[model samples]
Target: MKKLTILFLAMVIFSCNNQPDKGASDNNSEIASQGKIPKTEKEVGSNTTINDYSQVETEKAVEPDTIKTNDNQDINYQPADNNNTNQFEDNFIGFASFYMQFDKPKQTFILKADEDKTITCKEGTKLTVNENSFITSSGDSVTGDIEIRVKEYYKISDILLANLSTTSNRDILETGGMIYIEAFSNGEECELKKGATIEIAFPAKDKKDDMQLFSGNWESDKVNWILKETIPVDSEENAGFTFVEKMPEFPGGQQKLMDYLSKNIKYPTRAKESGIQGTVYITFIVNEDGNTEDIRVVRGVDSSLNQAAISAIEQMPKWTPGKQGGEYVKVNMNLPIRFSLGGEDFSTNNIDYAKEFEKQVNDSNLSNTEMLEISHYIFSTSKLGWINCDRFFRDNSPKVDFLVNIGTSKQVDIKIVFNTINSILTGSTSGGKYIFDNVPTGHSVTLVALKYEKDQYYLAIKKTKITREEEQVLDFEPVTMARLKAEMEKLNRI
Candidate 1:
């Protein structure tokens, strides 16, 4: 505690003596780690008496002569020397117009607190987070390398009004957009005071915002959306998805959600017992086609429980209704799900949630000889516009070579990835391609096609050292996504 206070005092004095000349530039870019939207802050305004600060050690010492002068002179600068004016401000503020949308209002903020402060969060301070989504250090204090983030503060209305050009502007004129701050106490959680600042640096899109990657559509119900893709230009799927003209339509909608919740939304009894009552935040993107892809748990609890939540969201129905300019648009929504021990059975008599689990969840059929034969080749003029052979053997196959050539897609490479490498199929000399002549006759074995990932495909065919030789050509059929999922469940049953 004493050391932290001393450090804070030292940094404050450093600030007063050293004022680096910052360039006339603000380049704000955001990066991501563990989960969704990149952001963070340290624990502030915490009770000094309760949380342990005794073991907190002083900052590490840096070797001298490390900081070079413009002339590359050996000025012998030590990092701990607070008088060096060459360092940048450890605090920074970032402002972005509304989410991936156009026409959002924006704000510019000033971040305080140097990395050396050893400070805790108060109700209205900003924090620059690390990969763990928490502020571990104050961050780079060098002038040219300052990182920007606000702890827990809000924009002032007067500050908001300053960014506007006229009273007629719908954005600047909106008042409720203000933020609030509250501090936690004894047993009562802190609630934001009516006008306390809520460092809401990320503003909404106003009438005059930039549109480039922000265009999207909302379905009539507004529950479903098809947001614009934010993928980089150099991505493999460059063309991306086409823009949907109507409000995005969800195939399952509420019913799918109900079933998903009922079947998979199991309560984390242990965590609940521990009294962690925070809401589980789930987020994912809805593609233009109404499919829920990239499901992830933004805020997590127990690892196993987190997976359960993700599974529930992933099995949801395609959404409908998201529009832009009255056209359905794709989008990503942050969802909050609450859990309690009582939530064990999220079902009513009319609905059997597990029953709605349309398909099985495993694919052990990989050990079936028949499955391998049935899935060998694609039927010409097949029902599917394009077949993903890799998916047929998802993670299990007899032949190790993973080759997939569908119409004009990229040259699908094939490699065999296995849970166990020395098993019969993986070590084949012919790239997992089967040769009947190499085996003895009259042996019985099973074969199943398996696909782990790109460049890895296999046939789950058993090598029967059969004395009686029988040669049979096989064709493995590609199953629909739903069917593939059902196969997975079927394996789980066994």
Candidate 2:
């Protein structure tokens, strides 16, 4: 019997690499390596020593060429020049905003350290973010953008209002509307804090930049925050998943994550001694800041194993974070960590490929030889089918391919999903065709198509059976906003 050798291959775990790769681990190592950390200074109004974490590294940010003064005075603005302007107690601020329509009003907060100095917006700060096009369910076009209303500013000791307002008057700020808010700590660090006068500037968005990319240096006696408001945007009437144009990614992608886990994960000595070896299911929340938190074992074999899994997860680097409708949002994720010693039982409990293949032949009402012939035809002729088969055979394993034709000329993103299967593979098409390979032979699958335009996503879905290699063309209407809202509600219920 040909077991699923791909899944059962022994993974070689290595010792953790102590030397941090650039953009690999999240710490002050980058700043330290660049020699940007400032000299130690005594904390004002406190007895502690201010450390590197509080200093601003102005190594990557370019200061604005001109500073518009409130009194019509032309003030020269330059980045930290390491002169008198770079005062020991000075601070720098940076700002960037994106156009987004919030389904619900979103509340955001700007966190500040206790040692932060008072914020002073010398020249009345105001920024106009150009509106972007987004469509409503009623086939209405809308523009989304934010303007700084310096007039309505609110100030407190450690917090300040964002003073943001929408450009369009439409109440499209209901559930499912999109909006953009740049996370403060989401870019390159520069040590550019100069004199008593605090300077703030906004960087132009680059083509390859994410919606929330803001790279500048914020400096002070301690790192201070400018905006602070607890604005909350409800994506739906019920807790709903706002599908993102791009999903969160590990720093070096999934392969690096696997490598990191292999290197960092430790088999609990106590669990090994007790012969406890099973997969540990862990779930965590990846915050908008790309940091993982709330990590806990959902399904655990033993306490020692559970703690070991949690420790390994806690040591992981920050992710790139997820974005929905162009705005960064917190996403929940689940991962399974396997902990097995040698000589473990390899039973159908793991995965039964032959049984599934036989069931596929039975369900298709075809003989084993006939099904094999059909699979061969698909692998040899169908372009997508060939690609799917090639991927399956690359691992020296065979799996059923589920191809679905959306029957549309418009370019839409498709996600072929198997409801009950393991080792699922991903494939894409240039047009409306989608191929999902590596599914269990005798199962069912679902295909979800989403057309993202401007800041809105129009969706369509179809479900079908999976038996051997075959293509299923589907007739699906564009998902209405009402239906999408209902689906979001159902997801919340689950």
Candidate 3:
């Protein structure tokens, strides 16, 4: 009996000795919750450091509300609350969720923090990050693995779905493209280190030489871009002269130049169908070797016409080189091409191309992608977040305020989309009304309003031309999620 008792005691002692320490188990549980584990004194030969979470105040997680459409499908819905002090804030959040539903999934890439890496997005956007280029919000250097999330907006449809607009300080902007980029290290948001710039080659179908870099500034619920600097125009190495002793001439003189343009210019089918007719002024540099280089649109009316004019000029044969003191020199030249359904041709006799070019250059209305016709927009940016390749829209039309009466004080999201320009504006509530101030008169626009109430979705869409300070009442109708999506898709076509 004594031998058996001694054996049992020995077994109990061995089991207890092999078990993990209670303090170590608790430490592991804490580390697991915090997502990182610090080395213990025994492991690092120093005291263990652990963050305290007891004093931290965390927001209560709100459960997503659901609504059943006519199709009997449950969809996540968040209604606006009028009782909230910041109605715009709530409306903006709801609008963001609504638009994000139609957006494509963001592209994600991983990189080592200690290595230089280049990530190419599926849409051909290239991002080059240098070694040790990232830091935390607290300004600490980031290490280990870094995660990059990229969202590219190239088409008008993409921009609409993302709820982005091409506007700066209430002025209009023509966009080449836009991109949203963010980085993360150890599941925490990271930023670029000081003096660190990520080289970006944002692919654009219509590259404009004057397309400038704009960084988005988020205020309230909308994003407004702020101009940074101009994108450099790619050109040959030469100190070109605006004036020369003898100007560059087209091969075989002015009449032949007109004939070349008439034969080569093919009016764009879309432009013809839409009845878009206007003149597109093209500027180019004739080098010492008599080759036309750096062709750009200094003034344009429509994208189709601008592209057509640029294409014809790009195919022109070498010109007779200009002269300065009887020696060949580079000279700047501008040509105006007319697109008319009436088949009107260019008459060189009535036009002085050089003087007209000089006057247009002095005009505040400058070159922009409003009519750009290139394959790619290349620029470098040090700032992250949302970056836009854009130019200010020059509109001299009269401006007026537009108002919408929703008839109910309930939460609503409103957007005013310009039909012709790449611009969108959010409506602000004032005196029980949603107002869009300083909108240009005599322009076509679409008004969209969205509402959610009692597990039902309500929507209103109206298209009209703003002739003056206009007021329209919106009648809300219950719509299924599918119908709402279809209606939003139509806005992208405009």
Model 3 Cα lDDT, one tens digit per residue, 442-476:
88888877865554467888888876755788887
Best by lDDT: 3
* Model 2 misplacement above 4 A: 1-243, 343-494
Model 3, runs deviating above 4 Å = 1-94, 97-104, 112-118, 138-145, 155-157, 230-374
Tell me how candidate 1 scores on lDDT: 0.26
Mark the regions of model 1 whose C-alpha exceeds 4 Å error after superposition: 1-260, 263-280, 325-329, 342-494
Tell me the TM-score of model 2. Answer: 0.26
Q: Against the hidden reference, what TM-scores do the models get?
A: 0.26, 0.26, 0.53
lDDT of 1 by residue, 1-494 (tens): 11000000000000000011110111112223211222211223222222321112112122221322223332221123354322321111111111111111211121222222122233212211111111212321222111221122122212111111111111111111211121222313222222211211122222111111111111110111111222211112412222222324346543344344645565555655664433455666666566777677766656756776677668766677455455444544445454434322222122121223212211222111111000011111101000110111122213222222222212111111121111112111143343222222222433333321121121222222223324333333433323333433332222
Of 1 and 3, the candidate ahead on TM-score is 3
lDDT of 2 by residue, 408-465 (tens): 5343445444443211223455456676545445546555455423222346656666
Give Cα-based local distance difference scores for all models: 0.26, 0.34, 0.60
